[model samples]
Target chain A: MASGSARSCLEEAAALGSAPPVSYEESTMPPVDRSVVADLALFAGLGPAELDEVLREARSIRYPKDSAVFHQGAEADAFFVLLHGHLRVEKTTPQGQQIVVRYVSPGEIFGVAQALALKHYPATAVAAVDSIALCWPSAAWPRLTSKFPSLAANALQTVGSRLQDTQARVIEMSSEQVEQRVAHALLRLANQAGRKIETGVEIDFPISRQDVAEMTGTTLHTVSRILSAWEQRGLVEGGRQRIVLRDPHKLFALAEGRVPSERSGG
Target chain B: MASGSARSCLEEAAALGSAPPVSYEESTMPPVDRSVVADLALFAGLGPAELDEVLREARSIRYPKDSAVFHQGAEADAFFVLLHGHLRVEKTTPQGQQIVVRYVSPGEIFGVAQALALKHYPATAVAAVDSIALCWPSAAWPRLTSKFPSLAANALQTVGSRLQDTQARVIEMSSEQVEQRVAHALLRLANQAGRKIETGVEIDFPISRQDVAEMTGTTLHTVSRILSAWEQRGLVEGGRQRIVLRDPHKLFALAEGRVPSERSGG
Candidate 1:
């Protein structure tokens, strides 16, 4: 190596002292100890001492499938991070219509409303599958934010992103036809938590026809009828709780407002 | 004062070599500033130094009445805080149908699309009237957030609130009737940006009949017909670019999907 490169390497070594080499990926992995604060998105750049302080106050929990992790209007006193498995965010209208807001996968966060205003959960989050999560009480937020400003900033950006998504959804509901809305919802679900199979992508969740209808803001009868039609056309395959896209291109065509009958041959 | 207490105070002061004279207000101002940050719901619990940094970087601008700030799909780079006046957020469908998204007032934010995934503005924001605003560049976001974690956390919370609002709007559009929607929209506008005057609470913005119609996802003709009927009943005073509510309580009754003709009777 050139002398300049060697000098920089020596400086880096001096700065780090003599510690075992750690890769970036390794650092992202959840810490084994319950109280060892891992570098979260909000606290990514914090010093080790500060992280230790956070970790001391952090707790971990495991949630089984179909668990009611939290309910809407409950006092928000903690934030959660999904270490593994899935979480579903949903809301119910006064008319008793259940709407699926979105799904949270690993590395994403839930119960962020605790940090927001109203100090209550705005939506209900359920453990879609057995999940591991990290919890930090709201009391620690002020101290954590003070010690790690970058974390707070990143959190804002994430919230901003969610706001934009919500706005787009509003636009869709106001403007797009129901069929297009359904298409968009399916595309979003696939993007968020789909598993790639040899035939096509499958949304990795035990979603029912009613769940799909609620998500698309359509009737259960309508959803079942449409799915049955698509199944006949070989666009998708559904059996019991599983839904697999056999031909996404055809589904895309339907989403763009083309009649399923017209595209049957294709 | 007790003699022992006075003596102990003097001794402690003398020990510190002439303690600095402190004003109660001045001493508390820092935390008060922190509370103010918290009030913004986008900077809850921000440290004094970080807030000072944000205040230093903020730029103020004035928007003339009815001027378009950012159109949909314009490159997004900054988010704005309304210092004064009102703004109308709207979107146009592919078929050229205009839909009112929301009316923003003082102390609220606009152009938050910069915080989301879009590189472009998602909607059109028009100054409903003469407006003063503070702008924060997206470039400054990273630095501001990194320096002030609470600010970032608050930003996330703000986004969450927006998401919840949008979700509600979607639910309304998907299920509610046009007339009901019009009443709801009017009520929301009155609450958010209307001025309570002797005549009634007039929408504190230069909104047209067409604007109201679009907001409710109805035709201008239909809105005009509805208003004309309401006017004859002495429920409202409708003028070019102005509408005065003669009785807010009665208007609210109408908004609740009730036939309030008797309330507006002679």
Candidate 2:
């Protein structure tokens, strides 16, 4: 991924670290700390022994920023729980168009294709930042789930939220204006990974206009124009693959279809 | 639903047909035969005692066509497994625009907001036709899933498939042409509920052009225009809420973004 300049985006992402591949028994891999995962939603009710059992079959690895943990259509032989940092899940349409499906936060269990009866990954998962994850072989899915029904319940909860979120986006794409959709997308990212700053809440990651376009079913030019207008109005600060909501309440009002307040409160 | 012509669409949907509401303990509700659900994917390997235990907590109820099993934003106190007929899950956006999320076929579980950790249903579920479902109270969710881990696994599988389906639609909506999205939506419906006929496969349900528009994130006018063109081209037969695919293979090709072939095979 670091060296291939000519590779397609997904292909470039696929050639990187995922997890131990029958080669880590001799390596000096540090033991995972239980405290790191005990509070995760996926392991909500899991005890120390349960966490140990779950982690026993897992291997920890770090993926560099912009590298793919798994490419779309690759064999889905493993599932993962992110221990740190962020991830972006992207899907490429059959017609060679790439869409940013969603972003993954830490403590989330992802890439469980076998749970979906899928043999291949449906999307490419890229590390948004340098990220560490504990991955278990797909074969362990049934046994682990059977032994810990809470895992299945938690997974169900996770998938349910995603389905609802995706459907919400579809509704927006269908009925809302492009400006409102972009506003909503920004709000979602901010809600997920916002960091408080003197100006406002920053998305806490590097996200390009192109990524915003893919996420909102709009064009990069349109997103650029909208963001520029918002920037000019001092509603947001944007540049260098970074976005900060300077007036988040105003953005929220815009997202709700309220008229753009010409009276700047800030 | 049968009498209200002035009510909001979602409100109109909220007026009838969920499971027992503290009044059916003495009513003449028929017992749900175990044979009907024994082979369903949900209860894959439950023993007789487990089945009896689950059924004891469930209530079976029939909903008439055009009625709602539950409304969006209602307290999500119960979950359901459809035993007969089709259901349409629809979400009304904050802007009050209705979007058809997906259709539910027999043997599918729906409205498990408790599993998703939501206190209210995010979408309204309507009986696309006369349908029957076995519903369990939300309180039973944790207990039942814990007691029967396979139920949780199966539910995860179901939710996983839905999440994938919704994400696929998002990818299509983000990148595909309206015609392509419409084609994909139709193909999905046909795949899910198509019944083989002498000439071709029929959707086997009353699906209006408005429904198609909602499902594909388009307008009724647009859907009507597109369907009419396909009808004239001898690709499909549409009338009276019935859609028969006269040339499904051709339609499949169209959905896949292939150049529409003018040469008819039939």
Candidate 3:
């Protein structure tokens, strides 16, 4: 349903924008397909007419790899739904340290601070790879929610689940060791973006040791040392920017702070 | 509108329960006042009829200090709206470490895992003080949302803000030092639960140094040392189960990882 031509039009539009060197040619962009809209669980159970109404207001845009889709503190004029590729949401401290909050996968929504009545984006969203997203103006939300109550319901559910996940991450950071934290972070990422490979499950992204360190709240050297230890134990394979989880069960045991033998014996 | 007799009835009913030793008697409980429903921001836009509909299905109950309103992993049959006092949401790791996720102030909602369609509570909610809450069955959610869309919208907004706050906490834990983390944590608590005192603003709950240490992912010794250091500098005053922020500006500067003089100079 998503075409290269549509993406090209979006890129051209993004190019016209002064901020982020992106342009947005609204009139020249192609409308999102109804099938694509239907595929999103957020819009499930909506009638075809409602789906058409949504697509009428939707504009698909493409962002080049490593380019910011939106910056922190920018006005939340619109919200986005990822259609393809990955996005990393990050927040920067006053001292300029960037912290990766989480990654967005296809079919997930982001830039939704407006839905919460927030006037600005809470974090920056950057394209981890060349990515496509369907965007809707914040003003259109109330009408859309009234027309399709499921959209509001689904969005609420998504926000609720994310809150629980973030709280869990807080608990992990507060109580777990760095090694266990790294293991848990990898397991979560793998669950979200893993693809089966000859070795095991690859994360299917170009995530480096530094990125892992950021995610786990540890130093790069510590992440490198842990990965090296895991590689030696055949629990994971890492090279350059790629990581393959060779033994997820062992990693799970480590994340639970238990010896692999203890898990196996049990 | 919350009567002592109604609280007694609820307590008698809770006593009949097999789980937690808390008591409550539903039979003698007085119907919740519609005015009370109107007072909650979550139900702000609803008409009197809708408010009555909500009250018809609501039960107001009391929780004594240190009592658990619900346990982690318990069936999430109902969601609650705090009417008075405070509640602390906590999660226990597998290694038996309890992490304080967040605290719920009056007029806020908690035990809302059911709103996400989760079968069980993701965290335990305990009474940080003698608390009162109005509860509604999870099954009542759909009807409530459909009748009063603002309820769903408001709840979503609340969850969204909490998610952002939690992510901010994760960022702090990952990037800031323990001292900065402690300062930020106390400042946040002060914002939410601070009460004016003769010297400074006191956190309006009986929170211990151990609680602060758990919140900042540090040891009790570290928290004590930092608080003592701050006391010496006239930044904060601490006593048995109490903390009063003597110099919020200084704490704010510290939280930003800057000295007080630098902030004043800027």
Candidate 4:
């Protein structure tokens, strides 16, 4: 059943192709406040003048939900920092299957293929929600790095850790059972975007079971069934486009392939 | 049958744990030549004097095939650049399943956790073949970067590209069928380590079917069966710990889910 649903999901994804091209409109928006740039991890240690120089030619842009910020094969002209809302980094395979690679959180950088001197964006960046971002033209990368060397170092660190995380995800997909994979995927999402709710920690964005299925490389039916089972076991609470971890510790153990009895007794 | 074999492989990997602690024997090895550093992509633009400064405190070390260079979770005291032979970067999941993350080619840098200021190695590095490398103590990172700023920038670019590649692999694992995944994996390995042979391009290292299975998150039986079928089809030649792609174009088409008939007709 899981494989059948996964095939159908892939078919749907193939039909979807790419998200509709993003529509850009001129904005009367003021420049992003330097304070925000100073607070960003990328520019944390930059002096006031350094931050000013880095933002001198920067522009603020807004993208509506479900719109492409940039396409995978398009020229990489600018790099972005998410100021508000969410963005999804995705790659469409040669076979036309769309995969969610990762999500860009507030203050995080995206479209960094330019930083690596790549001519084209390796993946598409789509706005998961109505989003605002500070954009710097690719031409400014060298100047910014020269002035603030820490910026380059910080970016490397971010990229390194991200590589480690991606490899871990590959391991999970290859070695873990579907239930364990779902558990691990949820814990990761919670770490990235979880918010405290009255009952538990909620993923602070709209995400359907289909999205979870896509992220975990499983099927919507499988994810729905697992989440329903977890709900019955008092491990998680689920509703329309929302999931709250009622007991994160148990989920963590499950992700490690430990049964509840083994976890409790051991 | 495939799942059963995969389960047994996982059991064996769990028993293996981390590569037996890397036993470093004292050697009369000399410092790496400055010219070698000049040739590396990471140090491409460094002047001879700058290269010398970078290697001032470096040491050369050798590891026999299958020996550990560094274990996952161990303190990262140094960063390394492969001088000869290949290394495999692997990560063990919480469930004790080992996944081959990536292969390190000569002149490529590995064990870069220290460069990212990470306290422990995120993955284990094992010599896939008898290998030699230049190792630098982590304490010198700041001074080295301060002297040659390009070193840091170059490292960032390397890490960025690697992160993109890892994400691409994750997508393949998630969305591609096992046959497609295996084809893609073999193609990647060929590109990285291929050597012109009498009949075709051969992966220039000792890599078992079991290794390929681990790399693709499948089973030995599955990999063996696929290889045997490809062998019969004249697309590849498989032998003990060796594989030669007799027809790369067909394999490439298969990886993209194109049948030979469709590909030739189109």
Clashing pairs in 2: none
Write the residue-wise lDDT of candidate 1 on B198-259 in tens digits: 98888877778898877766678988887888788787779998887777777777766566
Question: What tens digits encode model 3's per-residue C-alpha lDDT throughout B117-230?
Answer: 699989888888898988877778888887778888898899998998999999999888888999999999999999998899999989988889888889899999999989
Candidate 2 accuracy as TM-score: 0.88
The list of candidate 2 runs beyond 4 A from truth reads A1-30, A260-266, B1-30, B260-266
Tell me which of candidates 1 and 3 scores higher on TM-score. Answer: 3
Q: What would the per-residue lDDT of candidate 4 be over residues B30-121, giving only the tens digit for each residue?
A: 35678766778989888887787677667777777877877788788878889999998888877677788889999898888887769999
Error of 1 at B85 (Å): 2.2
Model 1 misplaced regions, further than 4 Å = A1-53, A257-266, B1-58, B92-97, B112-118, B146-150, B217-237, B250-266
**How much does each candidate deviate from the true structure in C-alpha RMSD?**
15.9, 5.8, 6.2, 9.9
lDDT of 2 by residue, A121-176 (tens): 99988988888888877888999988888888888888888888888888888888
Cα shift from native, residue A209, model 2 (Å): 1.1
Considering only chain B, report the TM-score of model 4: 0.86
**For model 1, how does the per-residue alpha-carbon lDDT over A68-89 read when each residue is reduced to its tens digit?**
6677777777777777888888
Q: Candidate 4 — which pairs collide?
A: none
Model 4 per-residue lDDT tens digits across residues A92-152: 8776777778888898987878778799999887777788888777777877876678888
Better of 1 and 2 by lDDT: 2
Worst 10 residues of 1 chain B by lDDT: B1-10
For candidate 3, the per-residue lDDT at B208 reads 89
Question: Residue A88: error of model 2 in Å?
Answer: 1.3
